[model samples]
Each structure stands twice: as C-alpha cells, then as structure tokens.
Target: MRTVAIIGRPNVGKSTLFNRLVGQKLALVDDRPGVTRDRREGEAELGHLSFRIIDTAGLEEAEPGSLSDRMRRQTEAAIDEADLVLFLVDARAGILPADETFAELVRRSGKPVVLLANKAEGRGGMAGAYDAFSLGLGDPVPLSAEHGEGMGDLLEAIEPFLETGEDEDDEDRAGKPLRVAIVGRPNAGKSTLVNRMIGAERLLTGPEAGITRDTISVDWRWRDHPIRLFDTAGLRKRARVEDKLEKLSVADALRAIRFAEVVVVLLDATIPFEKQDLSIVDLIESEGRAIVIGLNKWDLVADRPGLLKELRADAERLLPQVRGAPVVPLSGLAGEGIDRLMGSVVQAAEVWSRRVPTAKLNDWLAAALSAHPPPAVSGRRIKIRYMTQVKARPPHFALFGNQLDALPRAYTRYLVNGLRETFELPGVPIRLSLRSGKNPFEGKKKTWD
Candidate 1:
C-alpha cells in the first residue's frame, strides 16, 4: 500500500485533516498544541485512490536533554517511513522559524511533499499564504482543514503518487470470518463458557475472580464458519480500579470491544443486573456493534422459574436501546445450553452483517407509514416521504421527511423496533436517521398524470 504522512508543527489542523481524509476520528484531536505525542495510522481513500495515511507528532525543537527528545525521535521515525509527506502550516500564524527548519528537513528526505497552508478560511490568512512561499516547497495549497475547504486541490496534488493494488486485496478480505469478544464483570464465567463452546479445556478454569489479565483470542471453526473468540479481562468500575496493570487490562478489553464485530457480554445469573453490566451494554451500543447476552452459571441459581422472569424484565428495562436482543442462559461447567449460546451468536452476527436492498427498504417504509402515520405537531402533520439504507455494518436507515425535526424519540424507537421485528434482525443495533427537506418536484406534473 502507498503511505502518506501528515507532518507539521503543533496546532496546525493535521489531526483534523487526518480525520477528514480517513472519514473517521481514529486519531485524537485537541486545541492544545502538541497534544498528540504518538503516531497514529488509518486507511484513507481519495476518489479512486486508496492509501495508508499516518498522522505524526508535531515537528518541534526538542530540549537537548529532556522527554521532548523522545517525541522528536518518534516523529522523525514516522517521517522516514512515508512515501509522501503533507507538510501542514497554520496560515493564520504565518510561516514561523520552526516551519522553515522542518521544510528543510522534509526536503532532505527526498519524498514528495504537499505543502498545505491550513486555516485559510477568510482574508485573514492571505498574507500567511504569501509568506509560506519562502519555505521553498513550491506553491502552498491554501486550505481550511476545519471547514473542509481545498480538498480537491489537495487530492489533485497527490493523485500521481498513489498506488492502487492494495484496494483489490482489501475487497477480497471483506467477507472473511468475524472476530468476536466475550466480556463482563469478574466471575462471569466468560472463559469457562468459551471453553464449553469450543469443547475443550482451552482456557484455564478457576474459582477465583479476575483470573484473566490479558485478552486471549482463540481461532476455531463452528459448524463450517471460521470464528475468532476473544476472552477479555473483566471490567471494573473506574473508581474501584487500583493497580496500574489492572487498569491497562481494562483498556485492552475496551480496545477489543472496538476491534471486534460482535461482543457477547456475560452476566452472572444470580446478580445479572448491575451498574457495571448496564455500562457494558451502553458501551457496546455507543460503539454501534452487535451484542448478545450470556447469562452464565445458571446451574447455580436456585429459583429457575422466577429468575428467568426477572432476567427478562431486567434486560428489557435496562437495554431498551437494543430491544428484543437475545439473552441465552447457560452453565459453562456442565456444558448445558452451549448449542443455544452458539446459535444466538451466529444469529446475531448474521443480523449484524445483513444488508437491505434499497428498493425493498423503501417499499417497507411506504407501507409502514401508510399503516401508522406520524403524529401531528404544532398544527403541521409530519409527512415521511422516502427512506434509504445509507451504510450498514449494523443496519442504519435514513429517512427523508417533512417536519422531521419534530420527530419524537418514542416514534423513532417505534420505527427501529418495527424494523428489527419485520426484518428478523434480533440482537443487533439498528440506527434510524430523520432529515427534513423540500421536494424538488412538489409543483411539477407527473408524466403518468
């Protein structure tokens, strides 16, 4: 894959431009200068070109004998690994001494450089663009990174250097087996449950809680589907956390949650509803991933009938975001309910990956609106005209309507629930977005008329 590095002095909108190019906030951005101390990488596409873009720490003069030297070394190492460099400068601040020094350093590397004069939103930055000419990096591409201006010029500048072979390989890998993470509080029997499903003593069993420190991923075949299962450390509340190693373990689990396509949150049967468990569910919902609940150690619960009723009620009350999600009961030690647990995992994953055809999606929307019209508000009746599925890692629906700004949360939830039930999409998160716009053909006569 072709590599491009965004190199610049601090507070010059490098991270913002990085986010814009990558189409995601994979790198952290802040107003404070030099907030990014480490190099971050993300895959980016411009028109038909695709490349790996790296965002590096700001280029600055390091104190000869301080921690700043370490940062400078890291930044230099990242720059050395790039095929092209985007040297960004703050046009509002004009060309400074640091910019001149970095320009020489980048020129010496002999890589293709695209000098960007960022913050060029208005007349205030014209003089700074002129001043940037002294850096000898050719004409600057005047841009406003925050406002998403000058993207065309920036893309044109680097179009000749992009390589395209990697895109074919990426498309080939898109349908490969998914990675799943199983996590919850300590003593939730996550390891035991995973071992039961795999039919081996693959993970260590223990009576003590918090036995797993590092997140362990195991690759196995279920029926004919290839699966990678991750057993993560039990997450504890922030205030209760003490040791640094445990804190790091929690962070690792969180990272696994982000990396995995599906997350199975194991809950102790006896104490199934806790604040931490709810928080875990909320995290998965916020991350827009599919989730299934495993009520493990069910063999230990004495009141089986009453416990089942309570569990159902609690799940509905706590996780309304993912309504109708599957909650399977299993005893990992006894190898009971393993089939149901695996079945639920596969079902939820299938739903997570499912895509709806645009024609069928709009057809369903038309029928649904006819059956139950949106409520009237402020003497104006809400008219939902059409709908489309924009993007679907988990199905996200976009609705074009009149007066959609007044669409109530309850009505949105109602549509989401209807979609889940009608489409057989259980245990996966579904998003519904409403946008208001005027019809372009509102006053025109139809040909059929």
Candidate 2:
C-alpha cells in the first residue's frame, strides 16, 4: 500500500485527522503538546481513495541521546519510509519559529509535501493561512480537522499522489496469515520470545525494563502456515503510568490486542500470577480473543518440581473467564518447548474460529434449561425461548427470551459455563447477547394474565 505520514510541530490536530481518516479513534488525543511519542500506522480511506497512513510524533529539537531525541528519530524514520508527507500547521496559533524550523527540515527531505493549515473553520485563521505561503512548501489546504470542514478540497489536493490499481484477487487473500500478539508487563521476555520464534534478533532487547516503546509486527511462516507476530510494549498499572510516552505505548499495545486473533499472555514464572498478570488476562477476556498462558523464564524455576501443577490450579481458580487455557512452561532465552507452544497456538486459533450449527445449539440450550431452570425474579420465572450462535472468532451467541434484561449475573455465568463445557469450546471467551421482545398486553386493564 502507498504510505503517507502526518508531520508537524506539537498539538496541531495530527491525531484527530488520523482518526478521522481511519474512521475510528485508534490514536489517543490530548490538549497537551507531545501526547503522541511513537508512530502508529492504520489503513485509511477518503471517498474512493484507499492507502496506509502514519501518525508521527511532534517534531522537536532536543539534546543528544534524550527521550525527545529518540522521538525525533522515529519521526525522521517515518519521513524516510513514506511516499508523501502531509505537513500540518495550526492556523489558529499562527506560524511560529518551530513551524519555520520543521518546514526547512521537511523541505530538505526532497519528498512530495501537501501543506495543510488545520483548525481553519472561520475567518480568524485565514490570515495565518495566507501567511503560510512564506514557508515555500505550496498553497496551504485550509480545513478544520475537529469538525471535518473542507475535506473535498483536501482530497482534491492529494488525489494525484495516490497510486491507482486493482486490488488482489480472492485466491491471493485466502492465504492471509494468522495474527498473534505477545503481551505482558515490562521486561517479561516478550521481545526475546519473538526473537526465538523467528530465529533472528530483529528487535532491540536488554535487561532494562520497558526497552520496547512501540508495537512491532513481524511476518513469518511456521511449519508451512503463515503467521504475523506482534511484539508489544509492556503494560503497567494505570496508577503508576505517569509518563506520557508510556501511555502512548500502552495504547499501541491495546490496538495490537484488538487486531490479533490469538493473544499470548507471557508471565514471568518466578513471580507468576501477580495482580498485574491477572489484570492482563481479564483485559484479554474482555476483548474476546483466544488466550494462551506462557510461563516464561521456566529454566530458573526448574529446580522446584510440581510448581507447574500448582500454577495450573491457580490459573483455573483465579481466572474462571478463561479456564482450561493451555499453560506451557518454556524459557524464551533457552528456546525450549517452542514447538509445543506453536501447536497450542494453532489449536487455540481453530477453536476460536469454530462454528456450531443452529440446531445443535438449540438442542444444548434446551438440555441446559431443563437440567437447571432459571431462578425467579419478583415472583415470576424468566423465560429463555431459544438460543443460536451469532458468530465465531471467539463464539458469540444470541438468546431470545422475555424479561432477559433482568437475568441475574450468576445465571449468565451458568449459561456461559454450560456453553463452554457442552460445545467443547475452551479458552476462548464466549459472548451471550440477550434479545427480548416487548410485551403486547401492556396497559390493557387486566385483559390477560
């Protein structure tokens, strides 16, 4: 896909424009400057045009070897990789010394630039928009990103730069790779595990905590099956996440989870099942992705026999949402048990995509309701009429019944557990959607009982 990068000084509504183009809020937006530190990429569409878009950090001049400098390097890297650059400026704030500085920087890169004067909804910003011609990039495309004003003009400006061609055929798309994401707390050997899996040192790894600040995806094949593995930044507790850069990294990792089909929650075996670890598992279940618990750093705990059994018990007890998940003990550094881990991953993906027939699902629901009837509410029994599988990729079901909104939490758990056990659907989260029909005899002067 043709790539375009959004670049400019801090807080020029770059992320807001990015979210608008992608038709979703994939990037975090804040009023403060420098809210986005690392670059994030998403597939974007404008009218009939389709291409990949990148949201980069705010360009800044900082001291050598500082965090700000690192962010600058990421932006420069994006500029080098992009086919076109959308240089944005705050029309309301007017052109400043920083804007002039980055304009020179983007000019020296020799790439095609589309000058954008953002936040120009009224006549107040037109004076600054007219003054932008002094930068020598071109005429500015004035538009308000917040309210989406003047998009037709903006589209007319960039249409010539986009590549035009037919898309790939169905046979080519049938071979698409499976997406798997590795996520956990800081310094839990996620990058190391990725390196071992791909048999190459592609990612930067060290003993320090939080060495990775971006969610990197690597494409490879495993035993003839193509796979795309996502190595994400370590997620920390919200109370302790005080750094703005770390917050961006966490948001990137969460986007990775929502993109993947199966998620591997790698826990440090020495201190397995901490509060943070459980929290991570809960997040995965909430996302409704297939779960695989990886007990990394197992070599250090090899002397203690029967610890794996105890941890298995702990997993079943602590995380009932993902009970019966595959827990594999392996050392990412030593590369032990990788084959078993891959096998479990493939199996989990199959279960996650499995579909049950409507007849079979209705039969199971009948047996379950007969064996243990639903509890009464306000001296009336709730009726569950029928059930059917709505979709797959972590099985989702729809239940049609009367007064379904008043169903108790315990009864919902009972149904979910029964679905998991009876259908042989393990480790993947099941979604039960209650759909109730309105009563017809309401306010009828006691016409029916």
Q: Write the per-residue lDDT of candidate 2 for residues 346-386, one digit (tens) a residue.
A: 99999998999999989999999999999888998999999
Error of 1 at 67 (Å): 31
Candidate 1 lDDT over residue span 1-449, tens digit each = 88999999988999999998898888788999988888889999763468999988888888875667787788788788988999999999988999999999999989889889999776567445656778999767777778766564566568656744445566534544567899999889989888887888888879998899888888877777678899999998889999999998997788677657789999998788799999999888866678989898888984566777778778988888887788888898898987787788888878887888888878888878888889999998998888776556567777777888788888887788888888887778886756577578899988973
lDDT of each: 0.82, 0.88
Model 1, runs deviating above 4 Å: 1-175, 199-202, 438-449
How well does each candidate superpose onto the true structure, as a TM-score?
0.63, 0.66
Deviation in Å, model 1, residue 371 alpha carbon: 3.1
**Residue 386 miss distance in model 1 (angstroms):** 0.9
lDDT of 2 at 110: 95
Q: Which 10 consecutive positions of candidate 1 have the poorest summed lDDT?
A: 163-172
Please report, as a residue range, the 10-residue window in candidate 2 with the lowest summed lDDT: 163-172
